[model samples]
Target chain A: MIGCYDFCGHYEWTFEWLSQLGGHTLVRAYWDEAVHQDSQTHASKLIREKGFEGMKEYWGPTLADEGAVYERTVTDDVFRIDMHECPSKGFLLRNGLEQYRDYCDHCMGWIGPLMKDAGFVIDHEHNHCGQCWWEIRRKDDATPASAAGELSGASDVRLRPGWQSPHTDHYERSTDPDDKTVVS
Target chain B: MASSIPASLPYADTKPAGHADFYFAVNATFRFILRHHGEGALRKYWQDIGQSYYQPVSKRWSELGFAGVAEYWRAFFAVEPGAEVEVSEAQDEVRLEVKTCPAIRHLREHGREVVPNFCQHCFFVNEAIAEPAGMTVRVCGGNGSCTQRFMKATADLPPQNLEDIATAS
Candidate 1:
């Protein structure tokens, strides 16, 4: 019945299906329209209304419910998350289900638009594994991503062993998924 | 929250039940497909997933017959938080009596708008999965609860009427 018990499986599969039907553009739209605007409207509403505090209220319980292993660091200027173990990506990895090219991009695909609407920008990086980090700030802050471990201290995902993959997708102060720089 | 684990489920995760928020994405995906593409495309997507993504399930059902269907549903529903389902097996068929559908209940409780054709997904998807196993499914009732029967192709059951399924709000 398309149950959520295995939502990650079908969700990833649907990415490729949508892309097959209408290339990358359609996939992007699905994330922005279906995910960010529709499915994740709760997050949008919260973050938009409460700003940094909303990210706290939204991600705290949500990540705990999804059984993610992560740490959140917040200050007057920024909200940061160090994702040590991302349950969604870990599910696909454990199940050996890879339909979309970069499943990690979906995070930015939806969150980027959400942040832009909230008048914020994001500094993010992911190894395509279950590990990633995010730093969200006001669009006018003009501060670059904190030096490794500078914001999160020992909890920084980039400082962990095996943090380096063959390629790491990096997003600077940006609010578009397409605005990414691939690094090796 | 599940008491037992069935060996037939293809993918296994560390958590007992999945986060219910995922149902939102499922519903959103259906709406997106229905809005951008036609109904035919949405049906194709469901059938395609059942046939392709669920290949292992069909293969196991082919090996274990009715027993596999019963076992798989038991495990599947177990992880679905708030699901109330019973799976029973007999000589020729397996029956799933869903007292409360987790997806529908969760979506409704949260006040999300569900697509009217939501319940039909079970039919198309399960039919695709059963076809490869030389089995068939007949579903009646929906939106919140339903009865699904998995029987052999030779069972001669009447074709399912779309009207039997209730429209989701």
Candidate 2:
């Protein structure tokens, strides 16, 4: 049960792409036993109880069968086409896709139609790709280490009150690069 | 007929070889700090030690003590919680009981090293990582859900002189 919340808008397109992955599927049911239309409720419960295996077992076969057909429809790489080509539509590729330029191009092409269909405001003013954004934010003045840390909220794990996990403390401590060494 | 100095010990006013040797050994030990613990962390840890940005600190490990060392380790390395920690003396300097059998298998089968699997909720390895066990990793966390096939370690490789470390044989 790959539980995903907020799938009402552009995520529907993502769901379509996910459907093509071999031996993976999305079921509109709970427990793979009960008939349920609310994918959110069913997905949430199914994820907590049955996990990814259950999601695959219920959805995989169907998606795998239609994999080729789905790929043909959403063919172009929706990301990495060009900032100018389709700036707003390119934001769909989110899985650290800096390596695969071709894949991003295909995704950008594929998702451009979907983005338009979804009615998201296409903002061309912001041409910054994810890597570019990272670099801009990581400038010395920006204090990116702290900003990144705060945004991630990787700190503040109050586990068992007064029994704070060392991991959380460690993360908080590392926020200050002066006091910490970034060892990969 | 006149002794220049009073001899209460084996030698008067002259330090023993062991005492001098201890200091010499400590000087050697400090090299490890520079090699691993970055100069910035060392400076922050020991503020008054006069560790300058230009002059990197390859000294002062003994002065920092165990707690300081622990903090250094915690900062530098990513350790999975369930990887059994065996601390001999200080709260730091723990021997992590990492089961590398799965990693070995992964290397053999996929030609890649596998990071230890961590539970989404607890951030600890779900079970003892062993051979024949699939390399299951943290799929999600409290903050956001993670999809399967996401290795805990990022794809970025660390800086290393691999050839120097490799055996000639």
Candidate 3:
């Protein structure tokens, strides 16, 4: 899921306004700023310590190896995994999130493909919460009918519900866990 | 034109006497129609109202947006007081305009910089766009071009999943 911390540049102006009105006591007003700032910093630190290249590559092919690809709006199952990034190496069990877990059934599941599809492939994956080690992957496949253009438009004008208030709480920042899995 | 209520219009605990009658009647009519027919009737009712008002109201139907007709009706009722309103089949596409009055008020009370609206990325999210990895989009609330596009979270699959050879292979 594209959380709030992705676009820090655009929110700088909003923060300036909130800071003036809130002053020192404007904890609510500065919450988003604080979250974005912290996430960016944390992400950068992780990048530096690992000496990884680019945002996408930071996870390395090792993480991508165990990836799963699901069909467009199909089901709660994964199709495949690379041996290098498999749970045998323990990466899947360590960094998995929870949002990927809840689904058609309450049972635990991975989000890889059991078969190969034509237009789409897995793009990014995360666990539901940082528990249970079930992997969830965000699939990136285009529909057959004008899928490319539709996706381009979908990316700009209509993604989430239009009525979401701007002041909702932002995503929380968690420090790198000692239990977190890292691959060289 | 309807009279503009003072910015500091007194907040009343009870409905105004004269307006209360129409308000109650309207509310009751809505409830009665909704109770028997469900929301379908209300939607049709509004559609009919849109059709009736389409011609006599204005030539810029699209510009009227959702609020335009609503405002027109509000103004019409204020003047006519007891006019019986009805609508028929109407063919028009109405646009909805987002109001930033709360944002405006916050700016006025607090300071110029206060963002009375959500972040640009958030705006995209509200529109159902999720990732916004590429593509250039211009934001309306403030100045500057917001380059982010919208994307979506992956869909959850159903239970008893099948390994579509298309997906699995």
Candidate 4:
């Protein structure tokens, strides 16, 4: 059987497989339909019912379970995560497994839709090398993404050395994964 | 450095056990593939994964034979949380009696709708892995529990009957 022990490995490979089968559109649909709707419905329900609190509830145990090194900074208006070490990306990096073009987009691919359904928007960025930050707020809040250390002080991921890479992708108040602005 | 890794498993992770929530994605992938590409395509996906992504495993089994099959399954299921399985090895074959399939049980507990043909993945994937290794596998029973036998290619085993496998709910 295809066990989940190496799920991230196969999951990343599957992205390339689906992309080859029906191109980028199929990959996007897989994330929205299979990932966001069918697979991660529990996350959808939690975030929808509880809003920002649900995100906390969801990511707290999830990141911990997946053995992520990160910090969460939350205020009344927004929920933010500073991922110093993302477990999934770390797994692929450690194992030298890269089949798809951009595996990180998958996060926004699913979570973006989930946030939109929950009446919120996201400000996010990730370096291809497994470090990223996410700031989520209610759609009507209109607060901009915070500057480095504005929310989490020393815990800010963007302030880390080499945080900005030549290939960082940024999403500003966006809910669609493809809405990223490339940074060189 | 290479010797530190488990001989049976091709990949290694920092964690001892896997995040069980991934089973949900596995189920969803099956549903999506079947819906879009149909059964033949779905089977091709499984076979492809077994041949490609699991190439390392096939190589190991080719070198180690029946002993490798037993060792691999034992270690494979060990990290799959909620799995209740026994891998018994004899002179000629190895058998896996899956008492509680982790994916099926997890999907069921979460009230997820399972694809009816989900059980067939094991056969197609394992067959692909075994064929290239000069071995063969037969899978019977399924849904939540099943039996899988791995033996030499020349062993006079009958062809697997899909009807013997239980359809997933």
lDDT (CA) per prediction: 0.92, 0.22, 0.25, 0.92
- CAPRI verdict (incorrect, acceptable, medium, high) for model 3: incorrect
TM-score order, best first, reads: 1, 4, 2, 3
lDDT of 2 by residue, A46-66 (tens): 433543333334334433321
RMSD of each: 1.8, 26.7, 26.8, 1.7
Q: Can you list each candidate's DockQ?
A: 0.65, 0.01, 0.01, 0.72
Going through the candidates in the order shown, the clash numbers are 0, 14, 49, 0
- Candidate 1, residues A1-184, lDDT tens digits: the string is 7778778888999999999999999999999999999999999999999999999999999999888999999999999999999988998998899999999999999999999999999999999989999999999999999999898999999998879877799999988988999988
CA shift of A178, model 4, Å: 1.0
lDDT of 4 at A156: 96
lDDT of 4 by residue, B51-90 (tens): 9999999999999898889989988998899999999999
- Give the CA lDDT, 0 to 100, for residue A60 in model 3: 41
TM-score for each candidate, following the candidate numbering = 0.97, 0.18, 0.17, 0.97
Model 1 TM-score (2 dp): 0.97
Worst 10 residues of 3 chain B by lDDT: B160-169
Better of 1 and 4 by DockQ: 4
RMSD of 3: 26.8
